[model samples]
Target: MTTDHRTHARVAVVTGGSRGIGRAVCERLAQNGLAVVVNYARDAAAAKETVATITAAGGRAVSVQADVADENAVTALFDRAEQEFGGVDVVVNAAGRLALSPIADLDLEVLDAVLRTNLRGTFVVAQRAARRLRAGGSFVAFSTSVVATRFPAYGAYVASKGAIESITLILARELRGRDITVNTVAPGPTATDLFLDGKGPEQIEQLAKAPPLERLGTPQDIARVVAFLTSSEGHWINGQILRANGGMV
Candidate 1:
């Protein structure tokens, strides 16, 4: 769906774009006039639906399936974007896995699965983006506000996102002179399935209140920040972990 009509608009490849924050980011980027490549791991139906919604609104979009941890797959993801659109200007690695468990009783297998997706997947996508993104492009990865809050039972999840934050700056510095921006969006208590799953109303209420804004961050809230980061206006802001948690930190 490279029919963006607007020649000045850029292109974006978003992993996990089928659902949740990724989906929201795709729509927002489209509204900002960027042609979107919606990448999904397994949910082809959802991915197609996302593409349909965007295209229905006169936005250019296409769906592609790729496991974020697979280097070749992500490489092909970028290839698909370039094949559809002219070039890639923005890459958002919103695909992540979260498992909350106290370290004392941590399951090694669970840890491995979480890290495999959240860590290795991020790196694979970033590696491809590093190679494929055009000059002045930006990459935004996902992290968690819990990295600062240090909540219990979040050891595994926080550890993975923590590693993401650590690598983001190095990647940014490494991309010097390329004019690419690499940053992480560390959201806090976002109102998405990933955050709400397995949590009760009471827990949800507590988290909502934890933020000074007194509400769980909507997918759109975080989406807008990502939209800005990928835009030319945000090019000056590079190599930073933006806590889009509504003051949860």
Candidate 2:
């Protein structure tokens, strides 16, 4: 494995790191020489595969499982990072759930589930990162560009993500003088399983064509943006919502 030659190896804890955008983030950060802690909710196998991929690529990584909505589990996640990697410098809260239905027909239980994972999860993870991240650290949360699209049948999901965008600025301000940055990435339609699920071929084609780029976003596309925001070069960008869409607004 290629070792980071820096005075100290930077460590990152990435939620939902077992798959999709989270997996891409883990890989990118590892490539950047950060020791990564890959957090998955239920898929231990996928998590293991993620770690294996990194290790095979000569990067350092480990997998930990936690439901982002659970306070104790999240606390333990951070504790594990400190125990294993010395300290945490980057936290990416990418664990989330999506439930689509018109507001009138949406099941309250489904709405609750979506909020619990997406909104509550973001808050829980953010709180822990705010408390534990070292100076010069960063907390990157995931928000959806659908909040701007206002597409039908996305009321609950949009509502949850909207909450994330609303609190991002406040949280950044709350960490004043900490030398830490907090930002949310609001991505347009990306071709992850999460986005592709329930979408028919026709609908997917329509979305791919809607963006000026005339294509769907890959997970790596989003990860590059996340990596930049958490890197030293992006230190000055704070308390902002970066829309990583290809002119899909």
Spell out the clash pairs found in candidate 1. none
**Candidate 2 — what's its lDDT?**
0.94
Q: Which regions of candidate 2 fall more than 4 Å away from where they truly are? A: 1-6
Q: Please provide, for model 2 over 55-123, each residue's C-alpha lDDT reduced to its tens digit, 9 standing for 90 to 100.
A: 999988999999999999999999999999999999999999998898999999999999999999999
- Scored by lDDT, the top model is 2
Q: Looking at model 1, which ten-residue stretch has the lowest summed lDDT?
A: 1-10
Where does candidate 1 stray beyond 4 Å? 1-8
TM-score of each: 0.96, 0.97
Supply the TM-score for candidate 1.
0.96
lDDT per prediction?
0.92, 0.94
> Candidate 2 — worst ten consecutive residues by lDDT sum?
1-10
Output the TM-score of candidate 2.
0.97
lDDT of 1 by residue, 119-179 (tens): 9999999999999888878999999999999999999999899999999999999999998
Q: lDDT, candidate 2, residue 63?
A: 100
Provide the clashing-pair count of each candidate structure: 0, 0
